[model samples]
Target: MEHDQELNNNLRKVKEKFMLDLVDKLNRINRDGLEYGSSALNVCYMTSIVDKQILQCEEFLKDISRGYFIEDYEEDPTGYTNGSIEIQCLNATKTYTLKFTESYCGDMAQCYPSFKLSERHGVGEYEWNYFEDDYEEYEANFNKKYSAIYKDIEQKKKERRIQDIKIQMEMLSQELTALES
Candidate 1:
């Protein structure tokens, strides 16, 4: 019984650590992109990666809730939730595939998740093209393509700041009005 309690405590600590790491990874992906070759691929990979991690964590938590002792348990390292990540873009005119190796799950325990581009079609003819490992060029093009998104995000942030200031002003005005009364 005491051993079980100790195990549960240890599992809780591990889960907390994993959750923190997951959040950090997500923030990094959101800020810097997925570190994948292209923006499209980055978006696809990031979503899939986050989904997989969430599912895996949920499953582990479920097992723990059920009092199942999970030994050597770690986050799924399969590069994808499943075997491969398939993305269709350009009005379904282009398809891309990123496949994970059999060793990928094991590798995940040791390093960050990664995938290899297994297949691609209709490159250069669509909004999302296969990067062919040209990461530097891909990053440049991605930034250029998504500059508007960054601008819009900044605009929204500024608007929120303005709204907050207005709220503060109103509150102060009410306080002054009360004092004058």
Candidate 2:
């Protein structure tokens, strides 16, 4: 019984660590832009790498949960629950903001494992699906073309060439942001 308790504690620690790492990676990607402002292939590779790490963590957690290595605990406001676990989990997942639900002081203790696990797996698939064979060839072509343009500009050393490129890129970025807004 003690061993089981220790294993459950370890699994909880691992899950918490993995969640923290995932958030950090997400923030880094958001700050760096979706495309890396460098190369499509480079961006694809980086995303794929992050995706694999998250996937491995997710799978490990799922296995642990399957083995009943973690226990679910929640605070009952009135000391008696009125809703099914499934309903509570679904509401928690859908109604809570990521900042609130996934925060260090979050209410994830009440969250349903099934919803959280499914969302994690879906995100991992979305991240890695960008690197499949068909998409890889497309990205390679994009990288080759854009990189060649950049290389040509460097070889010529035209006056204010890099600055002009930067300005254009900035304008395009602004336009994209405006469109999204």
Candidate 3:
């Protein structure tokens, strides 16, 4: 029993750290407009819903069934509960927003939660079924793309560090010559 508790505590700590890192990355992306790239964003979005607890709220189900979802945030008398995020995508020429909505089961959102890229400005709504093989392929492809992007970023950082070190060495050499004179 003691061993199980220790393991759970460690797992919880790791989960907390991961969440912090994810939130930081999301914040950076929001501020800079996909500087980390869309593949990374997509992977992060999908990974968040892994093994989610489903709560079927009859209230939300009605709106969901009718094909209408809460697109924007609103403050009810009780509180503010908007389970939607507006993601901005910046390309070479233009910037646009994509809205992602969470599908939940229960009195509110995020009960047994899943996400969908429900709407895109200038483009229409989107639907992705999990049962489809195409969906699986799409997920795999997204993961692959994200992995590649991550590796490229790491490689570029290493190259940049090397360049910085060389510049520092040059500066140090110049400083030494001036001191000797």
Candidate 4:
């Protein structure tokens, strides 16, 4: 509708070859969201899974990713109820949260709330510096209304969607070759 730089790039060649192809096989909801399935864009908006290690290799390349554990906090029960790590996937504009769990520390601490990045979709990295002032409020919300986001689980779910796109594109490529022949 508006001036779309992407759709306009190589205007005639791309448009003629694969308008609907890019639109549908990429699992786009509409013509407007054609970019959603692009590899560049996928690196942007993953549903979950955030860690600093994503900065390494950084290819958006590795298919299999290993998970890590991040020790978020070890605090006393004195006035401390709960906590959350708000993360923005690198290149992604939206934010998702990592909720910690209070495990027994054998009296060393009352709450040893830790974050574990489990094996999953291996989506892109994240930047968790957006809402720093929410430590107090986040604990309140996590205690009252919010549910935890399992980075591994959610990221794997998103990974499935991405896999489907890849499979379908390969089918389409074969179809195009056959048609040309």
Candidate 5:
């Protein structure tokens, strides 16, 4: 009985560790993609790199969900397609949706992802904005925000490049080890 318990505990720990690593990798991939730039080539490269990680994360979630029972499921709300995905939490009785727009026109024109949370009673939305007009007053503010985001993207690219190098080194090390053995 004790041995069985130990084995189960070890397995649980391994699962947790794997999940954490996968989550970290997903985050890195996302950051790297964003940092790559908005050009078509960069976008395609980023998509390719991140797509596999996204699938792995989905598979990992599915594997873990097998241990538990899901109580409720719902079809997605109407008119929420085209780069939008809705997530409904059965346990919490809450629904969340993420929508990305290449160009969103509201008070201003901007390009970014929009996140929304909804419950039975109320809804909340978050979005980023950019200057739509050439007004001098808004120019300074807009420039500042744009510069900040640009700097952040550059920094992320640097971090992603370093991480890629590390991953390559680790793969090489494993191959060398196998060859030696």
Candidate 6:
């Protein structure tokens, strides 16, 4: 009987300790919220709401993204697409076509000129220089008649990958159109 009483007392102490720790954690969170002038709580609440809104936005975007296209035409001096954009995103690469114009009209004008993308477990900063020329022949004309075949292949691959991304961006833009409609 004495042993049973001792065990019960120990359990009661453990429970009290656990409750104390839980209360301390709650107090800390409350204090942090107050110390930051409720900004912390406001951010948390806003982000939670934003999370849902982002999903709705994503759905609308996905629908239109599937239909985006880039027309092939000579750009004027002022910089304009005069075409559509199309793209697809795969495991490690993407395919796309984008056109730029001086006017910020609508879908055709919404294309991003330059951007960067990187992976945590892989290479860093895969990006596009919108103004950079797709000149494999120029790069090959370096040094002797033809410096290296490997460089030529690599440059071609990089150019193709950029095109893929452009396609994906166009799709995303189409999806974004859903929000407006």
Number of the top-ranking candidate, with TM-score as the measure: 3
Candidate 2 pairs with clashing backbones: none
lDDT minimum window of 10 residues, candidate 4: 40-49
lDDT of 6 by residue, 29-90 (tens): 43444444431111121121122122222322333233322222222345232221232323
- Write down the TM-score of every candidate: 0.25, 0.25, 0.27, 0.21, 0.25, 0.21
For each candidate, C-alpha RMSD in Å? 21.0, 18.4, 17.3, 22.1, 18.6, 28.3
Encode model 2's per-residue lDDT on 50-140: one tens digit a residue: 3333434444454434332111222235623210111112212321111111111135353211112232333222222332454467557
lDDT of each: 0.40, 0.37, 0.40, 0.34, 0.41, 0.33
State the TM-score for model 3: 0.27
**Candidate 2: where is the Cα deviation over 4 Å?**
34-116, 119-181
Return the top candidate by lDDT.
5
The digit string of per-residue lDDT tens for model 4 on 98-134 reads 3333334446553333333222333332333323344
Cα lDDT over the full model 4 = 0.34
Our model 2 lands, by Cα RMSD against the true structure, at: 18.4
| Number of colliding residue pairs in each model | 0, 0, 10, 0, 0, 25
Instruction: Give the clash count for model 6.
Output: 25
- C-alpha lDDT (0 to 100) for residue 35 of candidate 1: 32
How many residue pairs in model 4 have overlapping backbones?
0
Q: What is the lDDT of residue 180 in candidate 4?
A: 100
| Candidate 1 C-alpha lDDT tens digits along 1-181 | 9987776676676555443443343334344432332122233333223323333333344333433221121123653432434433333333344333222333445322333332243211111222334434545654565455545444544566687799999999999999999
After superposing candidate 4 on the true structure, give the runs of residues whose Cα lies further than 4 Å from its correct spot.
1-148
Compared with the true structure, the alpha-carbon lDDT of candidate 5 equals: 0.41
